[model samples]
Target: MTTMNKLNQVILSATLALAASGASAQMRIEISGVGSNQIPVAVAGFADENIAPQQISAIIKADLERSGAFKLIDAGVITSMSNIDYGTWKAKGADALVVGTVAKSAAGDYEVRYKLFDTVKQSELSQLNVSRAPQFTRLTAHNIADDVYLKLTGIRGAFSTRIAYVKEYDKRHYELLVADADGDGEQMALRSNEPIISPSWSPDGTKVAYVSFEQKKPVVYVQNLITRARTVIANEKGSNSSPVWAQTGNKLAVSLSKDGHTQIYTVNADGGNLKRVSNSAGIDSEANFAPDGSIYFMSDRSGGPQIYRMNGDGGEAKRVTFTGNYNISPRVSADGKTLAYISRRDGNYQLYVMDLASGQEQRLSDSTDDQYPSFAPNGKYIMYATQAGGRKSLAVVSVDGRVKQRLTTQAGNIKEPTWGPFMQ
Candidate 1:
């Protein structure tokens, strides 16, 4: 069996944590494949960027390219908007254009401005201007990329969002890291000699609830990103694992083996008001919340593990997935219309997305050992972890399976990626 199979078989097991440590280097991305129909766009180098701390246009270009939504046409430092030849760009096969300027203000801040143009129509589409400290140059570039993405695709860009995953150096060394969507700007949230898994972000993107093995057993904890303070949410006897935040952010759904068999339960964020939600005799773990207050999870009550759903208060339990004999890790999209999960097919575990209303499903990944699927805030993509050649890394695939990207680190193995919501 593959590592994913082993992990899923013990999905309800307890998992890691030590004291916080310094941040690590960013994860390097190797994006491959592209959408069948990509928008052709051009981003020119920002004027006066030589004095800035970071190159704004280059960052924007990389962000857009990694998204697999745009085909970047090199503009080669055409920094002046007045010099943009729409006709020339159109003839060069660029349907859209982006040009910008960066300058240091007298008050010691960076002023950034960018404009989007429709080369086909020879008209300006939209523009934005912002001022930020030198340290936020990369963030400013990401914001501009988000604006451009929203303007062109009608979908909110997740470039400004964050993701959390566990990096495993060995059985005795692990770290929970939070980083930007592109995998840069990494900050260590927790580190330990034991293992950590199931890092879930709060709806507001302020706190993360994860299962740690600090006490030599599985326990759940919530950590504040700002102050680095944390509170134990669940350390009940037996295994405590897989904590997912509710939409309100005050409660979480977790799987605990404190009872006879591993089952699902809802607990207050403070680790109070623990309420059992799943009454299955078989293992009922990996509970995830839908937007409508329904809980979707995995259970083996029917003789095999399959996806099931119940009301928020654990009423009227019903099975949701039938085609697959083994389905774990059900991740509902923000809109509650789609579900992403891992399924075993022909002895290989792959990522799959299902339409809640239509009962139709499509496989999204081509890898053999994919696990822990997490949806982007926009629901346009799903990020998951897959292992190949004995090495584990993170991968993202468009909902339609047209685009794919691979993210790897300089050292260690990364897994259990949880994409964060749009920051407030």
Candidate 2:
């Protein structure tokens, strides 16, 4: 059966905490490798009469720098683009330049206009205009960063997405936190003395499904991000855990132990329409859905834990992994061409990816304790939890295992990190 060995559950009731403090608990990010040549970019402060110029530029620079794809030039050199000097920026080794202006409209809203320039070619690349309410300053900055990233990399930026994870304050206290992709502006969604695990985001990025050991038994709950209201989607005689959302966002694929052994099942977002997806006698859990409406999950029916695939209606079961004795936590890419999972090799648990068509595999992580590997929406990066300096922290790596970065908190251990879907 699937187990929650990392969770220490000794308490009973789970308290629903709504709108807990939004204090900034910054996550320190350390970049490891520059997989490719970093693009040199300069973001000039927006020309505005009210807003501080340095504030907006700092956020944009931080976002691009963290990706390990762009090298930011000094904002002090060019505060505003009222006077264009392309030759100066080009001489400073900058390939791209960004300039923008922010103003308050007659209706008391903020309007921003930005332009992107190709410094080397000495031509304009793109222009964008955005408007937002007064309270959405940070969000506006992130959207600007997203636009710049997409324009340069040709891939949709995930800067505006959120991340959900479990943080243990002590042995008896644990909380579920949701924060920005850069690990700022954290808000606590749930608090309990019991343990919480396996947080999965819905397709719309409005709800999260997770397993909470509140009643001294594991139960799955889906909580809405806006109202903070939760509904028990799975609660049976035994454990109900490892909830994964379908592409449609109306159904969930989960693992249940009510039938004596762990088996994969699908249920509506509400607690109805229960259907079994896998009928294996051994253990089967950690289900993930592909874009093609197929279910990929972990199973031990073939003597050890390995990945398996089935249709949407729970038919045509087939083994997907054969080289590893222990493989679990299968996550398929959004394109449905690659599969990332945890495998045991040389008595050490590590992360590996396999081509779904060719059945060829390549190891991605060297850590012996990496877990909960998740793919970014762009399919360019994979985020997972690993131990660093004896502390459990979250780390991300490119698909080819070239670029790497780690995000760690100063206090307690961070676990079960799941990247949210792109904002609609």
lDDT of 1 by residue, 243-322 (tens): 99999898999999997799999999999999998897799999999999999999999998899999988976899999
User: Cα deviation of 255 in candidate 2 (Å)?
Assistant: 0.4
TM-score of each: 0.93, 0.90
What is the Cα-based TM-score of model 1? 0.93
lDDT of 1: 0.86
> Which ten contiguous residues of candidate 2 have the minimum total lDDT?
4-13
Per-residue C-alpha lDDT of model 2 across residues 168-263, encoded as one tens digit per residue: 876687888887777765667888899999999998777899999998999999998766689999998888999999999989998999999999
Clashing pairs in 1: 14-218, 15-212, 15-213, 16-212, 16-213
Those runs of model 1 whose alpha carbons end farther than 4 Å from true positions after fitting are 1-20, 82-84
Off by over 4 Å in 2: 1-24, 48-54, 75-83, 103-110
* Lowest-sum lDDT 10-residue window in model 1: 8-17
Error of 2 at 143 (Å): 1.3
